[model samples]
Target: MEVLSIVLGGGKGTRLFPLTQSRAKPAVPFGGRFRLVDIPISNCINADFRQIYILTQFNSASLHLHLSQTYVFDSFTRGFVEILAAEQTFEHSGWYEGTADAVRKNFIHFRTQNPKYYIILSGDQLYRMDLKELLSKHRDSGAAITIATTAVSREDASQLGILKANKNNEITEFMEKPGPVKDISDFKIPAELRQDKNGKGDEYLGSMGIYVFNAEAMESCLANELTDFGKEIIPAAINKLKVNAYLFDGYWEDIGTIRSFYEANLDLTTLRPKFDFYDEDAPIYTHMRNLPPSKMNFSNMNQSIAAEGCIITNASITNSIVGVRTIIESGSSLNGVVCMGADYYESEIQKQQNAEARVPNIGIGRGAIVKGAIIDKNACIGEGCRIGVDAIPRVDGNYGHYYIVDGIIVIPKNAVLYPGAVI
Candidate 1:
């Protein structure tokens, strides 16, 4: 069946702060080499559902640039991955208020294509999914709307939209952000859907912010002015239409907050990471820099993922992600950190750091120490600097030099940590 995918390039991403300060959430660099947006976009391409339109608003320039540079289809093919930034028209002259509203505003574009089904996706999530399976389940069940779900523990209920599915996987109920103390025991998944088959099956079924809607169903729902899908559309659709739940049995992480984003990146350096970028068959595509091989001079590293164009000299690293174009000087040590290296080589703009406010272009300096931290792009850590060492055990607030979320220090984009600076 003909399908069109719509990826929601997320809003402000306040939780991600410094990283999303300059670029959209999806455009945020991830996994050392790829962007958060690459996950959903690559999934659509791998599933052969090539027609896609990304809906974005805040800080979308970088996201747009990345798309234009990376996703270029063949001349003969009709497929394309295009950007649909929020705009004003005769019908509506305001920004997208919510998820449903974003899609509602883009109806004119999709109506022309006349797709058989429409798939909705989130750009900031880390997961590898095959949309073909979701489409197949929707077709087999004859459901007007199909929601992709995964079992979440009671502890995670407050962070997601929980649901209840019957024996046939038809959703009967949904509760969005039902706070931790609230009881959701009645909304557990069925025993048959559990991985252990005979396990507890008490885990709540949570929405992955993924959905497949029948052309007619989506058009009919959009006729109204509902703003959000989870808070309005999906909950309302369950009562009037056949909404089925499709369970996902793989690793899926919502990188909406700094802690989750930090942990997810560090996971990439683990022995058996939940999400593997090394999978060749379903490779995550990105801008191929074609840079020279990384150079290392007596550097000691263990279980780390260092991208190309990185220069390491006498540094010791363990369980870290060193991004592209990084330069780590001698006597520097990094452990359990994510250093999102610079996008380009050092420039004249970098030399005038004292004249005008600017972040250092290079990655790190000599004798610096970083542990359990996330250094965003264009950051320059001066010699004798110490980051993440003074981080509070568990705090979520802004400190002048850096922000601490879940106790992990985060240096914002284009920021500078001067010599002997401490977190």
Candidate 2:
């Protein structure tokens, strides 16, 4: 079956704050060296769906650069991947209003391809699943739209889109960010199916924002008045179109906020994280071949994931994830953190402190100490820098150090921290 996979990669990731200030959510570095979009792309590739289109906007340049290098779709076959940006193609010119609107604006592209099915997915998430199986379910159900719903606790439903489905597995109701538990339980469901595996039955089904749509139905709906999916499109189509919900009880997380992103990174260090990054069947892909092998020299590193090409000197990194080509000089200590690549020129051997001194692109001087902090890519830290040790929180520009409300430290990219700055 010919399939066209469209992954949404345009969110600004504002909830991530400083991290997304310069990059899109999908481009945000994750699990040390990998970006968030790697998960979905890997799933598509593994599922044998080579025809892919990444719908990206808002700081898409970085994402485009990474995609160009890692993914190579063959033109010989009908399998080709490309990034679809929002633009005025003799129709409209404006920012993407919402998720559904974004796809609706690009309807021409999909109509032209005329694939049997359209797999819609959000880019900023961590999970491993086979799209082939999901597509099979969509075909067997004969639904106009089949949503990938996960059974999340009622308490966590506030942050997700909640769905109510009938015995036929057809979604009857949908609400986005509807607060309080009562609002979730009050939804009407047959009492017979109420005793599900979790005792709550179908009430636990929460929208993962992953959908498989019949090409014709989706094209017809796009011509309707609906603009947004969760807010307008799906809800409007529920009565008119055949919409079903497929329960996926797997590990899935939306890295939409800083706290969530921090937790997701630390979760990988657990004995068995919900989402396994090292799964052989669906390995997460990223851009890091240029990085050198990780070098540990008399450093006390424990329970830390060091990506390819990191150099650790006399420092001690414990319970952390270090990105590729990161250089930790002597006497530095990092714990329970996520460290991006460090500046190379600011090593202890090359100490240039004068105002006119030339600083390297990515460097962290000797005697620098970072604990429970996230340092973004390509940052330069001067000598005697201390991060995530202050009793008071430090909230500054895109480059300022952020004392995570939960204790994790966050340092944005390309930030130049002066000597003796307590972050």
Candidate 3:
């Protein structure tokens, strides 16, 4: 089947403020070495669905650069990964209002591929699946649309679009983010679909924000002024078209907020993360920097992940992710930190210039004690810095040097913490 994958790179990402402040949400650095956009693109390539288009509006320059540098298809194949930024055309001059609107605006470009099936994906989600299975289920069931659903708890259900499906896997009802007050007991997965025969647990089928749509069905669904897929399109489609559910019980995480993003990255430092990047059978692809291997000198590290081109000297790190080109000075200590390393190494002349200007170099300085923080790329933490280590309550907002969101300290990209700084 000829399939075209459309990844919706969300707008603004207000929930992920500082990280999304300068770049698109999907362009935000993730897992030390990869961008959020890499997840969906890698999945598409692994599934042999290479003709992909990423639709974005806000802060897409970095995303475009990353895509161009990372995904280069060979001439032998028709595979191409392209980005379609929101444009002001004569027909529609406004920006993409929502998920469906983004795709609808790019339909003129998508039609050139002439794909029979269109796979809709979210750029900021972390999960791995053989999309061939989704297509197979869509074809076998003869459904106009097939939405990938996952089992989510009641607490999580309130934040996601929940649905109920019959024994035949046909979606019967759909509700978007039914808040705590809404009684959604009737929306639980059918007893037949439950692996537990007793059906004793309350497991609701939550839409994964992943969908497979027949070309005609998608075109028809978007013919209206409906904007979002979850809020408008999917709910309407369930009532008018033959919509089915593709049950997926995988480790899927929506990296939408600061808390979720922080926890997901920290989880990678665990012994066996829910999402593993070491799966050689289905590897996650990213930019090939080919930097030198990370170098450490008497650094006592445990349960940490360090990417290439790092220099560590007599520091202590625990349960952290150190990105490429990171430099941890002597006597510094880090725990539960996700440090996005520098973009480029500073030359001795640059270091001298920094010293003259009384600014710390582009890395963690000596005697720094950082914990439970996210240090964005090219950030500089000066000597004697204390971040997320003090016994003080922090309100969520953007400070001059750092911001605290979800009670976690976030040092934005290119931000600097002066010497003897304490947070």
Candidate 4:
């Protein structure tokens, strides 16, 4: 079947503030080496779905650069992973108001392909899925739309669209971010569908924000002037249209907030993370940085993942994800932090200029302490500085060069913290 994939590059991502300040949500760096957008696009490539388009509107420069640098298909194969930023044509003049509206504005271009099915995916989610199987299930069920749902704990139901399927696995109803667990009765999964392999069932099916829409049916659905899938379109289309549920059992994470993003990255440093990034058969792909392996000199570290091109010297590190080109100097302590590392290695000439200017290269400095923080790219923490130690809790404040979000100190790109600076 001919399929076209649409990865929705989400809105401003206000919940993830400073990280999304200069880049789109999907373009945010992830796992020290990859971007969040890479997750969905990698899944598409692994599934052999190459005709893909990513939709975006806000802070897309970094995203555009990342897309151009990575994901190049041969010209003759008619495959591409292209970006369609929000544009104002004579027909529409405003920015995308919602997810469905974004697609509706792009329908003119999307309809050109005349694909049999359209697979819609979220750009910020972390998962490994095969759209080929999703399409197969959609074809077998003969449904107008197939919504992918995964069983999630009751605690997570409040943050997701809870789905209810009938005895035949046809979606009977869906409640988007329901208020309380008791209010989920209208959209709770049936007992048979809820039964686990071990015969212990407690979780409810939650929407993964993945959908397979019959192309023509989707066109019609959008023709009604819908603005969102979960909030407006899918919820209204359930009883009026033939909607089915596709069950997916695997690890999935929706990293759409600061706390969630931090926890997800730190989770990777575990013995066996919930989401494995080292699977050889179905590996995640990203832009290759041909830098030397990490070099450490008497650094005391444990339970961490240090990426390539890092230089460590007698630093104390633990339970952290040190990104590429990171420099940790002596007498520093980094615990439970996600150092996003530097964007580029400073050349010898640049280093000389920095030295002449008395500017330190981006890194954690001597005698500094960084705990429970997120150091974004190109940040320079000065000597004897303390961060996240006396940081104001649960506050969002900008300190000229750095930001604090929910008590986590975040150093924006190329920002510097002077020596002896305190949180």
Candidate 5:
């Protein structure tokens, strides 16, 4: 079957502010090396469905550059990965209002591919799925639209689109973010579909924001003024169309907020992380920066991940992720930190210039102590600096060079912290 994939690069990620201050949500760095967009793109590639298009609008420059540099298909094949950026045209001029609106606006371009099916994915989620299996299930069931669902607790179901499916796996009802007050006990999964039935609690099927749509169904659904899939199209489709659910029990995370992002990155430093990047059979791909191996000088690192070209001095690092080209000076200690490294190493002349300007160079300086924080790219943590370590509670808001979101300290990109700085 001729299938096409569209990844919805989300709107302004306000919840992940400071990090999303200068780049698209999908372009945010994750797991030391890979971008958030890499997860879905790599899944599509691994499934051998490569005629992909990423739909993005806000702050897309960095995402565009990363995609152009990373996902180039071979010339011999018809496969390609392209970006369908939001545009102002004669028909509709406003930016993408919602997920469905984005696809509807691009229908003119999508028709040229003449695809039989389209797989919709979220750009800011982390999951690995076999699209081939999803397609097979869709075709076999003769479903017009198939949504990927996962079992979630009542608390999680309240925050996501929960659905009810019959024993045949056909979706019956859909509810979007029915908060804690909503009585959604009827939306629980059928007993036959439940893997664990020790009578723990009601398990509801939460939408993963992943969908497989027949070409005609997608066009028909988007023909209306509905702007969102979860809030409008999918719920409407459930009443009129043959919508099915492909139940998945896998490690999936939506890194849409600062707290979720921070916890997810720190999770990777654990001895056994739920998400594995070491799976060589289905590898996650990114820009091939040919940097040398990391160099550590008398450092004590435990349950930490340091990317290539890092120069770590006599520091004590535990449960942290040090990104590429990072330079951690001696006498520093990092615990439960996610440090996104610099874009380029500072030359001797550049260091001299920084000294002359009375500014700290990129990366953490000597005698610094960081704990439970996210250090964005090119940030300079000066000597004797302290972050997320003091007993003083910080309210969540912008604080000049840094921010406190969900009780986690965030150092935005290229922000400089002079010597003896504290947070």
Candidate 6:
């Protein structure tokens, strides 16, 4: 089947705070070396669906650069991939109002290509799945649209795009981020999940915000007026359309917020993490440079993922993910931290506080210490600096840049931390 994958990469990821202040959420550095969009794009290629297009608007320069290097659409015969930036024209020239609007604007291009199915996806998530199975199910079920549903905790269900389905796995209702008090017990679950077989009360399968739509039906729906798939489209089509629900009981996480993103990264460090990126059959492909192996000299490191080109000296690092070419000096200690490239060493000493620019690589200066924090690219740290160690609040020169959350300090991109500064 000819399938087209549309990854939504427009969200500013405000919940991620300092991380997304400069780049879009999908383009943010993740898991030491990979971007969040790598999860979906790699999944699409692994699933044998080569035709892909990313929809981007907010801070998309980095995302576009990454996509250009990681994905090669020009070398394929029957496959092509590209990014569609939001544009305004005579009839439609404004930025995409919502998810549905983004797709609707791109429908003109998809119509020209003429694909059989459309796979909608979110950029900021981590998972592995054979999308072919979902497409096969959608094709066999004769539904106008098929949604991927998964079970979340009852307490956390309110934070998701919830779905209500009938006994035949047909969706009957759709709710987007409903409050915790909302009751959705009327929906029916699968026999295996049912408290009583052939009973009434359902498990309330929540929408994964991933969908497979019939090209004809999708084009027809897009031709009409709709702004969001969950709020305005799916709910309106629940009674009038044949919407099948495909239950997925595997590892999946929506990294929409910083807390979830941090927890997800930390989860990878477990003895048996819920999500593993080392699957041989479905390996997550990323930019691989022929850099030399990471060198650790007297580096008292334990349980840290040190990427290639990292140079570590007399420092103690535990449960941290260090990016490429990162330099750590003597007497520094890092625990439960994610450190990206930072700029520190300059040709000459910069006297102005703001004159200290971010380094092209990350560095933990001598006698510096950090714990339970995420430090983004090109951050400079002076010796004896301590960060993300306490609940003390600190703000950037501009008030709207960053806010500490739950004691985990978020160091924004290009943020220069002076020597002896403590958090």
CA deviation > 4 Å runs, candidate 2: 188-203, 288-290, 342-361, 393-408
lDDT, model 5, position 281: 85
Clashing pairs in 4: none
Question: Which ten-residue region of model 1 has the weakest summed lDDT?
Answer: 193-202
lDDT of each: 0.88, 0.77, 0.92, 0.87, 0.92, 0.78
Model 2, 142-219: lDDT tens digits are 899999988766666777778888878989888887776455576534455543444443355678889998988888
- How many times do residue backbones clash in model 6? 11
Clashes of each: 0, 7, 0, 0, 0, 11
For model 2 the TM-score comes to 0.90
Off by over 4 Å in 5: 196-202
Q: Which residue pairs of candidate 3 clash?
A: none
Candidate 6 local Cα displacement, residue 70, angstroms: 1.5
Off by over 4 Å in 1: 196-202, 347-361, 390-395
Tens-digit lDDT string for candidate 6 (1-423): 478999988566777767887777888887777889888888888888888889988888878887887777545457756889888767796888999999998877787878889999888988888898999999999999999988765555677778777778888778887767877565435547744212323355778889998888787777776898888888877777899999887788889777788888877766777788778999887766566788888989887788777788999999888876677888999999888753233333443433445332246777889988887777767678887765665443333323465446677776667677787
Ranking by lDDT: 3, 5, 1, 4, 6, 2
Question: Per-residue error at 277 for model 3, in Å?
Answer: 0.7
RMSD of each: 2.5, 3.3, 1.8, 2.3, 1.5, 4.0
Model 4 residue 314 lDDT?
Answer: 91
* 1-423 per-residue lDDT for model 1 (tens digits): 389999998788888887888899999999888999999999999899999999999999999999999999998767899999999999989999999999999898988898999999999999999889889989999999999998777777788999988888899998888988987777866555656222434377889999999999998888898899989899999999999999898888999888899999999988889898888988899999899889999999999989999999999999999999999999999999998888898766556764366343367988999998898887889888987766446477777767877777888877778778877
Q: Give the CA lDDT, 0 to 100, for residue 411 in model 6.
A: 75
Candidate 1 local distance difference test against the native = 0.88
Q: Write the per-residue lDDT of candidate 3 for residues 1-423, one digit (tens) a residue.
A: 389999999889999999998999999998889999999999999889999999999999999999999999999888999999989998889999999999998888988888999999999999999898889989999999999998887877889999988889999989999988889988876665665322335478889999999999999999999999999999899989999999887788999899999999999999989899999988999999989999999999999999999999999999999999999999999999999898899999999999999999999999999999999999999999999888978899878889999988999999989999999
- Global lDDT for candidate 5? 0.92
- Location of the lowest summed lDDT over 10 successive residues in candidate 5: 193-202
